[model samples]
Target chain A: MASSPQLGFTTASGLEQDLAKLIVDSLRLEVAPGDIDPAAPLFGDGLGLDSIDMLEIALAVSKRYAVELRSENRAALASLRALAAHIAQQRTS
Target chain B: MMRSTDSQMAPVPTARRAFAPVAAPAYPLVAHDSPGCTLAWRRDRMHSVEEFLRSVWGLAAQLPPKRYAINVCKDRYLFAVGFAAALVARHISLLPTCRAEEPLRRLAERYSDAYVLTDHDLDTSMPSFHVTDHARHSSGSMKIPFIPADRIAAIAFTSGSSGFPQAHAKSWGSLVLGAKALGRQFALSSSPPRTAVGTVPAQHMYGLETTIMLPLQWGWSLHAGNSILPADIRTDLERLGSPAWLMTTPFHLKAYLSERTALPGLEGIVSATMPLTRSAAQEAEHIWQVPVHEIYGCTEGGMLASRRTADGDAWTLCHELRMRQESGGTWVKGGHVGAWLQLTDRITLRNRREFLLLGPNYDLVKVAGKRASLAALNAALLRVRGVSDGTFYWPDQGRSGNGRLSAFVVAPGVSRAAILADLRRFIPVYFVTALPRNATGKLPHEQLETFAEQVRHSGQARTIHECRRESFETEARRGFSQGARRDE
Candidate 1:
């Protein structure tokens, strides 16, 4: 589901947006989609999610994308832009 | 009798000095023959160490070449045997996973020919190599190979509480060093009581180091069973004899203390997993008359710091491991700190040598632009009278534009208003919501979302019990009204 094309979204961007929406939906964040900075921290200050939230997100991501989200990696935090890039890379390769 | 008195009473100081040889800094699993101590499994099963090792080695030889083995058994002997087998076979051992399936699949993907070595009873569909009864093999001294200490011994999975578990590769030397530091810090050898037992799973870092590794490395005998039931713990200690140490988690320790069982002789107790509350620590010590050693560590960083309750509040870092807080308030650089071992916890560094954890780093929530720690919120909730256990969860933002927190509590006697009043002391009114608990006393995260959905649809603030009643009434009324309409 493309929410909007003007969001400058590639297929990966669309996927990341969808995933971000899913995370927000699952965690029940009070913020709007427009408020979430793609590059801002989802864990600490920006989104303020805890380890349990991360675990829930990880499981959800794994079940949805068949991708393993390792907790110990910096890649775990990279930009929604980078996540989009990664998803695009995964999909293409 | 005069000659005996002359020899026996000849200044007791001389005899004490004679017995006190310079105690070498011993590693955790190195000490074996303590006075009145033998591996309980050996005594019960009638198998000596040499005999046990040979049998374990025999099993190792039977396995196919270069097979990766994962050991998940809670039994000390089985864990030891499997670890020895993996080493002897030069096969990689996969440490236990916190959440299975996805992580196991990832490991399977990496090590294509990996075989899980489990106890005979576990029904794993994956290709598994069963550990045979070691007693059946011949009685001979085990010729354990001198593998390089730096060799990647095993991969322990981090309990990634919010995501897929990550694997932390541990070298034998690093793990041994960490265990040695732990044993020393806890005074495993020099103390009055030398025995160590664990209630936590030995696969976890805290249990692995304190319970399994310390015994194997330092030669301290470990209790066979790993169960944490107070009765079982007391029984195991009595069976092992006095001056025993119980390695357990805050969860089990709290439960044990709550049960208020008459504890047997314990030299000390070591707690990990979650932070041990000061009140809990005091209660355990006061009730059991044993020192509670609080250990702080994670899979990525093997053994970080430990504090004996007798020594006061601060935790001293292990010998080799060092801690320095990053400018951003996270502790970094420990013994096993890998390339990306950034902690998920916040800590206040008193100095390089000691620090205090400030709870989960990511638990801070901004309500109407005001920052509040979720840990503080949950702690506040638990402080309320009659509130047993509670967790604050965020509601799905798509339906509700506000990212307010929803709470699931196991407060039996407390009313919703009372709980809200308690929360209101520290939190804003808009941040609170209600969620349901399943039968097992765990709030299924999905169910919380459903509760949130019900709240959103109904546009009402209903307690979990009230919501259930409303749903029941709605169903009953629909059934009756539909029947009357059809009859007319």
Candidate 2:
């Protein structure tokens, strides 16, 4: 799963790198892991992703990071950086 | 002996018929004894139509008085008031699909003296007015102005050929007649007044007719809240209480369904803007316990046909309209359409009234509830300074929820970043290059990774997040978060 950490996500700080790689791998977006900007917003506008996409991401994050993400948890779903921070605090892995 | 002038002098009484025809400029925009004064909702608050009229007359008094005005208010109530005020001021509303600065600027350039009206105080180059900027006026003892049925009321913008916005000029008579068709189609007159909540913006033609105009013309009311996450749609519906109807597009309906939030009770659902799949419509009917009636329409004509989307794909024309196909094209005449019209989609006539959507005659793409011409987007793509050749592609299936529009280009030495940046101005896009050793060459999937890497590295192209639009969205996000927390 961590195979091509040599580029995009691998260059980021440990926590966000893992999450970015997780999102890129799970959704199968045509962009690089590094391309999913750490501080970029995770919902709505910038991602061009809908809430349905977020559900897929949430399921993937729960399995990979071992943490439950509530849809109402604004901070946890705010952006990649915020999400990474929340995961760092709450991940049981 | 009676003067023909006497007939014109009196109020053209709205047809006493159970379902009646409305002449555009012939009758009052809002009837005198029409009874209900409830205008629409602005979030949780209910605004009265009387107060709405006061705002209209009040705002109309302050304007410099031009022949046309652009209403870009996001609040449905403000939009309603702005629209009515435009009519009262004898000005035509220039309804643009987007409130983006460039589009509004182009509209201002085209209309010359047209002013921008909105609730937000965004910096606009045109003469501008805010909804709250009105001098005092009274809602009481107000008289609804009778519009000449032939007067052009509004011009709706849609992407046409040549990559520029095309205008469909609609008159008050046609708009009113169209509303009457919808009222009859939905059986709105016999049923108790329904409170409509639309996910589509009121400025768009479908949104304008279904959410704003239908209710206003037919004596119902609307919820003023704007679009949020799907759960908020439920909140908006529940906030308005029972006997409510939903006016949304396939894109929004699918999103709201994913939330699985229950409304208090709904009368029915009215969807337009894009094709609603049978399954999506069925799911809504099964879960929300409401009949899903999809309005078949385009910017050129208002709501013309409707059908139970779950009942398969046959659409029944509004009882007043008739259709006949000529030269492989279907045309509709009569009622508020005001002229014999050509349809964008090819239709196979099932009878005098019902027909199936065979498919579009020309390519039109609806992504995330916005319909843009594929040819127009492609023309805009190739028009970009760096591009040699390009084309746009979106998912053919009903919104897979991935929601990203991709482009393929054949411009050698034109940095992918530059192409992307240029294209993003037209539509939010992600693209792959097929620049073989030859500029005009066959496309392949293998070169994507190498091309993406080069594109990512070249030029100072910015991610969507890096743009100024991101700040606006972030501000909106903060507001939505605050609202969500309160709901919690």
**lDDT for residue B328 in candidate 1, whole number 0-100:** 73
**Stretches > 4 Å off in candidate 2:** A1-30, A40-93, B1-25, B31-36, B139-141, B360-362, B366-371, B378-488
lDDT against the true structure, each candidate: 0.60, 0.69
Tens digit per residue, CA lDDT, model 1, B247-344: 88765676567556556767788887656768888889999888898887777887778876545667777766666656675655645453435666
What is candidate 2's lDDT per residue for A1-93, written digit by digit as tens?
Answer: 132333233322776877877887766564678888777887655665655457567666666665656545777788888888777666434
- Scored against the true structure, residue A86 in model 1 reaches a CA lDDT of 58
Pick by lDDT: which candidate is best? 2
Residue A6 C-alpha lDDT in model 2 = 33
Q: Candidate 1 — which residues are off by over 4 angstroms?
A: A1-93, B1-37, B40-47, B98-110, B139-141, B159-162, B190-193, B309-312, B334-341, B360-488
Docking class of 2: incorrect
Report the lDDT tens digits of candidate 1 across residue range A1-93.
333343445555577777778776655554566567888877656665544455446545555665545433447555555555554555446
